[model samples]
Target: MLFGAESNLDLALALYDLGGVQFGDFDLGPTAGRSPIYLNPRVLISDPAVLRRIALLIHHEIQADQARRRPRLASFAAVAGVPMGGLHLATAYALVSDTPLLYVRPDSQQPSIEGRIIPGQTVLVIDDLMTGGTSLLRTAKALEESGLVVRDFIVLIDREQGGTERLHEHGYHVMPILRLRTMLTYYHECGLLDTARYRTVMDYLERTSPRRWSGSP
Candidate 1:
């Protein structure tokens, strides 16, 4: 029911600006050649209060999801993050919920010998963005190989590029705090964003969206 509420969207947009998360003008090619509206949530670490606020946002979203998803992740065994990018956000969320923290490292080794490096509990994967969900999927695999279940993925943004859909299609539920469409629309409505700049991103995302909707890499 909270999916498209105006206040949640307003708060999300406010966080996007107040957190000072930079959005890139150039595409970063998770699409191989397309990229637009890059967001860096790492900036929140510089401000402890903002970091906590971000945590609160995540906590609220998780609470809502727990009450909603069947099999109920309310007592989720642990919180796990995809390496390098998702570590801090995962830590922040874990700190807020008083939940245990786990991490999925890049398995740069031969297949069978890659144990103890990935996650090992029913983990909730956190990341700032879900571009193609490459890292998320790999992390989930690593978790499973280590006898874990990754039932849910949470992200700060879901670029409207089917990242969210793909994750759900792959049998993992996705909870995104915000999507690019409403985000861009909110900023444009508030005059926080230039029309031309916003248009460029909207057009780019449209053109670069994957033709096949499968959640594969």
Candidate 2:
């Protein structure tokens, strides 16, 4: 794996220092009212060095997954990035992996097959973060309608907010590089997160999680 346990722990701490993960009251969405911890991957785009590192990490992980035959990553013929947030990440991955890149439209605004994807191509869909898998499902549907096969989905962070389960139910294998619960635990252990903030964020995640899913050990 590109980011082993120790390396991932360091990455989580680095992201915290980068102001990507913040503690405070913030809006999650219409359904999820308010949140104590907010995660934003867009900040990484501002720093080319960090963004390239992230892209390389993702590339290495994908290569490792392919080597291990984990969820059959080797079958992927192209990388499809869910629009708005995932485009840059996918671009970087393509640059590193020398894979074809496809940008899935956010909605049905464009022709289904207009992007860089070819019909009958197997694609691995990627996104920045997954909260409920709603956007990803939409993107996958569009890809399928365009005659592309999508079986695997990837995200930079999984909030453990039921998105993975939801995607699995739809027959899509989901891979998350970092999980919110794990990151929070690491932050707390390293003293990067205070006790009160840690408890509050943990409570909020537990309360808001659709299935109250805890990440893997």
Please name the candidate that would achieve the greatest lDDT relative to the true structure: 2
* lDDT string, candidate 2, 125-178, tens digits: 899888889988988988898889999998988988788888989998988888
Task: Give the number of the best model, judged by TM-score.
Answer: 2
lDDT of 1 at 102: 75
Clashing pairs in 1: 27-35
Q: What TM-score, to 2 decimals, does candidate 2 have?
A: 0.89
Q: What lDDT would each prediction earn against the true structure? A: 0.70, 0.81
Query: TM-score of the candidate numbered 1?
Result: 0.78
- lDDT of each residue in 97-200, candidate 1, tens digit only: 98778775555673232223334457788887776787788887777777777888888777777676667679887777777777888888888778987898
Clashes of 1: 1
For candidate 2, the per-residue lDDT at 6 reads 72
